[model samples]
Target: MKNLFFLGEIMSDISVEELAVILEEDDKWLTENYNKLIQQYPGQMVAINDGKVVAVGREVRDYCAARQKAGLVGPLLINVPHPDDLEPFLI
Candidate 1:
């Protein structure tokens, strides 16, 4: 079974299992490259497609625009926090 999802102005059909796997892989990629991303794009939003950075911007809307312009379909978008903004977890 497949479900219809919106990717910008286009709608595509994807299976639930496929979407879950894609989300999992995207999350893993983010975790694996977190430090590098922080160093390169501190306090910015980054759009990741297939484990690569496709767009970056300071504002959410700007990043969305950039992502759309780059023709990225259902890419993972996440904000990289500045090191200073992270609170230390003291046990």
Candidate 2:
């Protein structure tokens, strides 16, 4: 299961149109990095910021806390399972 996190995009100041744009951009980032991420972090969680990977870990909370401490508010956090065991919500 891949989970996505957006940083500043979630701020209250953003309007509905802005939110949609942010989501669309985030989606593109994920799609563009999908294959590379799977090959690099098979069966692990990866943290990405601005389309660059920040870290890879087995535990979600631990990795997220690290990113937060490093001042990364919103990162694309994805769990890359086995290639054959693709998560149904990927699309």
- Predicted model with the maximum TM-score: 1
Lowest lDDT sum, 10 consecutive residues, model 2, at: 1-10
lDDT of 1 by residue, 1-91 (tens): 0111224332166666876777688779988999899889998888777788888888768866987787766677777877776657423
Candidate 2 — which residues are off by over 4 angstroms?
Answer: 1-21, 84-91
TM-score of each: 0.76, 0.65
Clashing residue pairs, backbone N/CA/C < 3 A, model 2: none
In terms of TM-score, how similar is model 1 to the real structure? 0.76
Q: Write one digit per residue (lDDT tens) for candidate 2, span 11-89.
A: 5665769666656676788788798888778888877666677877888777767786787655667777667677675
Q: lDDT at 23 for candidate 2?
A: 60
**Top lDDT model:** 1
